[model samples]
Target: MVKAETVDKAYEIAKERYAEVGVDTEAAMKRLETVPLSLHCWQGDDIHGFLNPEQELTGGIAVTGDYPGVARTPDELTSDLHEALSLIPGKHRVALHMIYAVAKDGKKKDFNDIKPEDFDYWIDWAKKEGIGLDNNGTFFSHPNVKDNMTVASPDKNIRDYWIQHGKLTREVSNYIGEQLGQTCYNNFWVPDGFKDNPIDKLTPRERMLASLDEIEAKDYPEANEQDSFEGKLFGAPGIESFTVGSHEFYQYYAITRQKLWTIDAGHFHPTEDVSDKFASYFPFTKKDLFMHVSRPVRWDSDHTVIVDDALLRITRSLVRDNLLDRTHIGLDFFDATINRVAAWVVGARATQKSLLQAMLAPIDQLKQSEYNADFTTRLIETEELKSMPFGAVWDKFCQDHNVPVGFDWMDNIHQYEKDVQFKRN
Candidate 1:
């Protein structure tokens, strides 16, 4: 382990270098501490929530590997989450799907039948951890997702069942925010589309909009519940031809309804990116925007995030546009192949590292150069900024927060696997 004084010495040297370029390392670290990345709970258990363990995971989602020690109950998931959070710097929130709701008597309950009390334990757990909560209505992997249709189902009964579930989920989200004293970002996404070319794509989309309207009709207090919509380009094998909730559809819907629009990293095509949409949607967002930061390999594989160019660009855009506070960032990838806690720490740290790097950049200088019409200097400085001592600043940030710096976290993960996870089998 690197000593505190050594980390401080590295920070002081890096701090002087950054100061010369008009960036304050200390202020950047302080800013990063306030940004809470919502950690998705599905990663700990590979999205196999404690809802109905007997049901098979379907509806375009699958956990690739059969890695052992997957959390089987709410308590086990909570324990794993606690271990992961300890390794990640700064306070963070947890993102929960409706399926994670725990019944008081440990009985299985259907979506529509679920209540806020089902999530009482989560709220209590969040309180103890001193973190906030975000929520999502699970719209896939259920019987009601008949023929891969959820909110956009042509059948009235199937549509109504999902709508009731959505309404109930919103209520639970509101309750969570009310209990935690922070606005919970309640997101809605559906896997409604056809495998082959559809004769009428318009009808399904229209149905989905109506179903969502009905779900949102049950107005909850804005202070507690802030709702948003997510759109995907495609889904599992059969649903590639048409995903009912495409990006354009939800972008228009969110604009019209004046709600936050969620941009999931894995929801877009590999060539396309949401980094450019920051300025476009920043004006339309009412209160705050939301993002599901997942690493997409070719498609929505939900790979653990690394400090790649795409992620750096996203964070840079947010920092350059001054939208960090206006955006609610959350991690949303699940890789069952590796140690789940290590996956969380890796992705969460990568996210924090990217944010810190962006913050430490001399964006003001770059902007000033651009405004002066010195395009050559702007290009040169931007390229040169890449090699700056951002790692030193990141090390200091982790040191200040008392979390492991760099690969030092791997030691803790190895110990955890032997002491906790290996015994799960």
Candidate 2:
């Protein structure tokens, strides 16, 4: 581990370098503290939620590893989350799926009949942790998923059941937000599609639109509850041909309905840059944006995020456009091939690092160069900025936040695995 004195000395020198380019490192770090990432809870248990431990993961979703020590209960998942959160800098929120709800009475409840009280255990835990919560309605991996569709299903019984599930999720999300005193973003993403090219594609989308309209008809306090919709390019084999909620579909829906729209990094085509989409939407929408940051390798593999070019571009776009305040950032990847807790720490920290790098950039200077048509200076300065002492500033940020600097946090993960995770037989 690097000594505190060395970290401080390096930060001082790095701070001077950044100042030369008209950037305030201190202000950047301070701004970073205000941005809270909503870490997804599905990573803790591979999306095998507590409601149905034996239920096969259907609806075109699949987790590819058999890593041991997966959290089998709500308690274990939260404990693991606590450990992961300690190593990450700044305050963050936990995003939970409705399927993870706990019953204090030890009785199973029907999906449509679920109440806000069912999530009291999680709300109570969040109170103690002093962090806010976010929510998503579990539309997949349930018995009601007929013909691989939920709200868009032709069966009225199945469609109504899922629509009611969506409505109740809004209530539960509102309760969570009220308790935690933060706006809970209730995101909707359904696995409703067909494997082959359907001749009646128009019918499913029409049904989906009507179902969503009914779900959003009930009013909730805007201060506590906000609804968002997520779209996908494709999914696992059976549902790869046609996704009911395509990007165009949700983009239009969110715009017309005045709801937040979510853009998952891994939900688009492999070559499509999600970074560019933000600016395109800002020109028209007045609502806050929601994002699911994930690393997709070749496909939507949901790999553990690393500080790569794609990740950097996404963060840079947000920072350059000055849209951090209006954006809700969240992680949405589950990699069961390695230690789950470690996966959380790695992905979250990678995102934070990317954001810090973006903030440290002299965007004003870069913009001025562009306006003056000084392409030469813009190119040279950007290239040189890459070699600046970014690592030092990052290490300093970690130290200031009381988190482990550099690779030292790995020691905690290893020890936790031996003492806490490995012993989970």
Candidate 3:
């Protein structure tokens, strides 16, 4: 089942997966002291009940598709997000990311649903209210794709309103920034890549690069603007057929001064090292970073909140490498037709639990320093480098550093154990 109950379900799944059927794992669990599946779980039922106070997450406004039933109009959407943020008193911001469904026709969206006036209105409205937004999946607010209904036949060789959307986005964003009198973060990434026979659809890196160059050339300092890059694991094939870590994205930064990659950890599978595939674990962060942090949703595109163990290791790895600046944790979700606020809460809690797992590291600077150099060398040209097995190498690494608590899940010894058991069972 989709990991609907992130904390509860993940633990249950772990319990089942860890069990050996006839073989014994009770002994193993006893030996390990913990299953180590400590996820960050938060109760998401607080959105409607802000009547009582005192609860909040850290600084980050996750721009998301509207929460169901809760926010419909632009006013409600903006207000709902604000309510979530208010609950977390110490937290100046609560994270958010958008899915197009909020403001568009569900499966068949059109341009009439969105327009420049729509853009002008929201920009002015956000400025007046001092609100900000971010997009993670296909967004109606997106420059080109948002108006998908208008371009009945988008140019295959060229993106539909891609550049136009960029221009509009720039106008709206800058207007908001100037109005809010604060820099608002803009994130870019559509589920734009194909796999296998669909390879020809791979984004022409040069063309995309040129588009980015055009935007950069326009003279709006987008890099200094709060923007990030995010990818989804599942979506309509036209936009979703691509694999997770396409390097074409690298050129995007080559042209612009903006530096941040939105990392949806669950977007990758067990075999891909997201760091290598994208560029480096720290390339985007070298400028600014926005992380779409969550566990890998296996074989499907449901934004379930469970944090994959391997994804956690990636965070620790990033910490080891000093790449936290790019780490604006955006927890995205769209599961069942549940309460809008609860859906947001589910996604938010899952992200938190994943972070808890990420923090498992005991923080050995010496080992991390040594590992960082070696990891980079090996990761030179691989995608999803955070999810590979180099157990022998890691063992030697720990031995060399003389730190006993360091465990790199990149060394897939445990995964191998899990795989072997799956076959046996």
For lDDT, the strongest prediction is: 2
Ranking by lDDT: 2, 1, 3
TM-score of 3: 0.53
TM-score of 2: 0.98
Q: What's the candidate order when arranged by decreasing TM-score? A: 2, 1, 3
Q: How many residue pairs clash in each candidate?
A: 1, 0, 42
Model 3: runs farther than 4 Å from truth? 1-70, 86-89, 92-132, 135-160, 191-203, 222-227, 231-235, 239-248, 251-258, 273-285, 307-311, 353-362, 365-425
TM-score per prediction, in order, is 0.98, 0.98, 0.53
Model 3, 315-390: lDDT tens digits are 5555445454445555544443444333443454344333333332323433554577756633442233333222
Write one digit per residue (lDDT tens) for candidate 1, span 1-425.
77788888888999999899889989999999989999999999988787787678888888888787888888889999999999999999999999998989888887777889889999999999999999999988788889999889989999999989989889999999999999889998888888999999788988999998999887788889999888999987669999999998988888888888899988998998679977888677565679889999998988999899999989999999899988999998889889999899999999999998888877878888899999999999888889998888999889888898877889998898889888899
Cα RMSD of all models vs. native, in order, equals: 1.0, 1.0, 15.3
Q: Which residues of candidate 2, in runs, are more than 4 Å off?
A: none
Candidate number that wins on TM-score, 1 or 3? 1
Whole-model lDDT, model 3: 0.39
lDDT value, residue 173 of candidate 2: 93
